[model samples]
Target: MVLIRRMLAFLMLASLSASVPAFAHKDHDRKQHAAEAMHNSAHQEGAPAASRMHQEPMHGAMEMEHSADEPPLTFTDRLLSWIGRLHPIIVHFPLAFFPAALFTATIGRRRASFATPVQFLVVAGGALAPLSALLGWLDAIGMDPDPLLTVHRWLGTMIGALGAALAVWAWRKPDQDRSGLMMAALTVLTAAIVVQGWFGGALVHGVDHMNW
Candidate 1:
């Protein structure tokens, strides 16, 4: 009976000892799995910062390339913008002068009261024409050359010369029929200047002639 009891006790202890190794193995496996999961999580957290660092140089290089491709603004551009604004005002003098002179002279020849004012308009117009021509020439030369540019140049020159000639003749005349002749010359010159001004407008606003 004692032998039977001893055998039963030995069997229970052996079974308990075998179960301890299996529990220890399961615990070790769980710890290994936790360690691997922590390592993977750490790598995932660092990935985006590493990617941003790798791409930063490429973004900087692209920006530099874009800057290199763009052209720089220049002094000539500023001068041209200023001149463009002034061009319309400068062109009107020649358009008004010759006709005003003629009208005044005709009225003065008939009535005598409109002569002085008309003469003043003629002289002022004549003076303004040359200045306009000079500015026009500067604007033309500053731009790329075109076929129509020559026409503008010659017309401006002719208008300026005619204005100056009429002005001089008007100045020299002693308030007689010769003043009428000078007024007629101014009238013709005024017509010519108006045509020239129209062409200049067409060159600027209509065509791409003067524009860069």
Candidate 2:
């Protein structure tokens, strides 16, 4: 009976010893899986931040390249600006000079003694008319193309023609009584020039339709 009991106790101890290795393997597998899962979670959490950091420098580089590709403002820009500044003053001279010449011519013809001064003013005003017209045309060309430019151009041509005609008449008149008639015509032409000048001024300063 004692011998049988010892053999049964040994068999029970052997079975318990065999199960210990399986429990240890299962615990090791669980720890390995938990460690792998923690590593994967950390990587996933950092991915977005890493992507943004990579993209930020690329975005900054692209912006820098775009700015570098742009052209700089040039000397033509400054020249045009100066032309625009002088435009109004150049245009106004003919407006004043033409009318003054006509007035002086009228007074001179009435008195018959002041014709020389009137003739001189007429020639001077006529010479200035074409110059003013040229400058005005240049200024118009610098601006954006518009329908108003057509009107301004035609008016300038008409004024130039009338000024030239008046200058010739004043120069050629031979102390004749017909000087009064020529002066009267000049007065009427000057009136028309004044109206045209006003229209040009409105185009520039009134609606702000022009570009420098």
Candidate 3:
């Protein structure tokens, strides 16, 4: 039963993970367009290669062919792409773990027994947050630049850095501080994640994805 549940969860995650070749395909199209434009100019100068390209009208027919197809991904390329796709899945861990840690820490104010869970959650989030951020950066490669992407990328970087620092702070000071500084810090981290999530959704859906 446990194995079945785990398998189902894996399947769900795999379904959510999109293939990376599409991103690379966009890069390829840009390069192809640039190359063809250069060749088009060269054809004006009677270059042999451009002479051959002029045999068919690009805007009328050749453009359709180039736009319709991209080079196929090899098994190894797919395998490597799977690594970057892990970002979407791995990010959930810190999102849950950080907030849960904050909650656990809040409750631990009344019951000391909650201390262990708080520390464990913080440590777990710290371990995964950097990996998630790294994968996110990898996934962003070859994607078109945008303001939303800029905000999401750097914000995620900050989250990963702060998460690690928060974990270290938790480990060093298991007991509450006089000012509750760690709790305050944890709150900031959680808030950042929420904001980053908004930008991420905008990137995935559209800028007005949440519009009424």
The candidate that achieves the highest lDDT relative to the unseen native structure: 3
Candidate 1: which pairs clash?
A: none
Candidate 2 residue lDDT tens string, 56-96:
99999999999899886578866765675675676566677
The residue pairs found clashing in candidate 2 are: none
User: Which stretches of model 1 miss by more than 4 angstroms?
Assistant: 1-85, 174-180, 207-212
Better of 2 and 3 by TM-score: 3
Model 3 regions more than 4 Å off: 1-64, 67-80, 176-179
Q: What is the C-alpha lDDT of each candidate?
A: 0.74, 0.72, 0.84
Report backbone clashes per prediction. 0, 0, 0
Tens-digit lDDT track of model 3 for 1-212: 99999999998877666445666788899999999998887767677667667765765586778866978777876766778898999999999999988887787767767888888899899989998999998788667989999999999999999999877777787775212787898889999989999999999999898899
Q: In model 1, what lDDT does residue 147 have?
A: 63
Ranking by lDDT: 3, 1, 2
What TM-score, over all chains together, does every model reach? 0.55, 0.53, 0.64
* lDDT for each residue of candidate 1 in 4-112, tens digit (9 for 90 to 100): 9999999999999999999999999999999999889778878887888999999999999999998875898767657756656887876776777776777677666
Candidate 3 root-mean-square deviation in Å: 16.0
